[model samples]
Target: MQTRRTFAAGLASAACAAPFITAAVAQSATTIRVSTAAPPSDFLNRALERMKADLEAANVGIQFSVHPASTLFRQGTEVPALQRGNLEMCSMTTFEVAQQIPELGYFNRGYLFNDHAHLRRAFDGPIGEDYRKAVSSRMGIEILATHYLGTRQVSLRQKRNVKGPADLAGTKLRMPAGPEWLLLGRTLGVAPIPLGMPEVYLALKTGTIDGQENPLSIFSAAKLFEVSEQVVLTSHVVQPVFLAMAKPVWDKLNPDQKKAVETAAKAAATWGDTARLDDEKTIVETIKGRGLTVETPDLKLFREAADRAYTGADATKAWDLQGLKRVQSA
Candidate 1:
């Protein structure tokens, strides 16, 4: 009886080990890697950290992690990487994905939101839903959630007191590399130059450019205030960030894992978006405390300029314009 019991225990152990052996024989595996453009010190970084915790808290039987500062791909290469399945997932800017899906710019159209509440409503409601569908269908990528990186405003190098939109006319600015941004500059009669982000500080120092448009966190992270003594808040557009996963990796997730990821995505989006607002105010005050001048210029005129520039562009229709207008009014 004792000998038979020992044999039975051995048999049970062998049975449990069989699955691992088969799985090992079937395929090689890797951690589910998520990438982001922000350095580890930024709020986006913190949000990703929270996501990692939430996913780990799930106690799921899989490896999950994040790669920061484009370790997997360059800053703008995020969506293309998603298409090729070079990486598992990413949380990136809309402009980075614009080439693949023009509709990804939906959240950026016009002066879309009066405040954070309005912005959240638009994204959590019909406008955000439509935008997600368009990207999923047109871009061949999955949209987990969309978020705001804070409002775009002008940060200037020299102490030119900007009282209104007319101040931007003839100002040479370093715009992101794309036609839409060029059109935006031309609408205001500003000479727009496309320069890589790393080059902006030296460009400002050497007087290569007069100003730049970015959310306050970006300006602070890049230390733009060292050369740029003035910050003019125009709130021209809300910079949109998206969490996306490669279709292949997305397909491999079990139903429960998929639901957990989706839930974490929404939570991360909300955390990153709201935390950015707080960071923006803190950074602006810090810059001002260092003796820099900050002002909220003619926001109305700036909005009009953005509207005039975006009119008739193919990218404009990708956004549910009526829905956005309702949110704006709300």
Candidate 2:
């Protein structure tokens, strides 16, 4: 009788433990590390938080560890890291990809986008798909969604009013160290001084560079106003930010996980786009209130100059002029 009782107790214990074991297995989480160059308070980081929340709430066993402000990988290194599978994901600008695939530089061409809506339409439609395929094929990274960076503008050390490209001639403007960026600055009649982000502030403060161009949000976030006295509303380039994943990491995801990631990416992009647009509306006022002279220059002259520079034979060799025209019309 005791032996039978013992066997019954053992069977009961096994049955009780089965549910716990199954539950533990089902709850196992997959952690993904995502990195961005933007700070935690930036819209991009907020979007990343939204993605994390949605992914975790879905109970799909996926989680995210976000590293902001280039903590995981430095600004320029993100691309190479993603290519080598050393990093899982990054929020990066399309210009980073253009460095490798020169044809992608079409997106960075000055004054190419008429407005934010035009830029979004191009990305959400066929043009974005074509670029995504090219990036995957050449760089081994998959673009998840398009996010807004902001419109590029020129900020100067003093209230040096620039009415046209002629006024900007010989002015040393700090730009990202790249052929495309240099070409853009040169086309605008500025002597482009290639500098990294970290060096910008010190360079500006000590008069190493007379001016720089970036979105107002970046200028505000980086506290560039402290050094800059005037902001020219050049709006030379309306560029889009990209959420991308290393192809190897993306390939490892199962169908359900892939769906979760895609859903989260789209949501994050929407959130980021809204935040950026809202911020742009009031950022100029905020900057001006901080004692900066904001001017809206004759953008027509700048646009004409950019068009002439980018349509030349050498420039067209790097970018598809016809494709660019199609995007503009689209």
Clashing pairs in 2: none
lDDT of 1: 0.74
lDDT of each: 0.74, 0.86
Task: Tell me each candidate's TM-score.
Answer: 0.81, 0.88
Error of 2 at 16 (Å): 17
| RMSD to native, candidate 2 | 3.6
Whole-structure CA lDDT of model 2? 0.86
Worst 10 residues of 2 by lDDT: 307-316
Q: Write the per-residue lDDT of candidate 2 for residues 1-330, one digit (tens) a residue.
A: 999999999999999999999888666766678888776777888899999998988777776878887788877788888888788889867678888888777887888898899999899999989989999889899999998888889999977768899999989999887778888996678999988665788899999999999888878877888999999999998879888999888898889999999999999999988988999999989998998999999989998888787766364577867887889898
**Cα RMSD for candidates in order:** 4.3, 3.6
Residue pair clashes in candidate 1: none
Query: Candidate 1 regions off by >4 Å?
Result: 1-30, 96-106, 187-189, 312-330
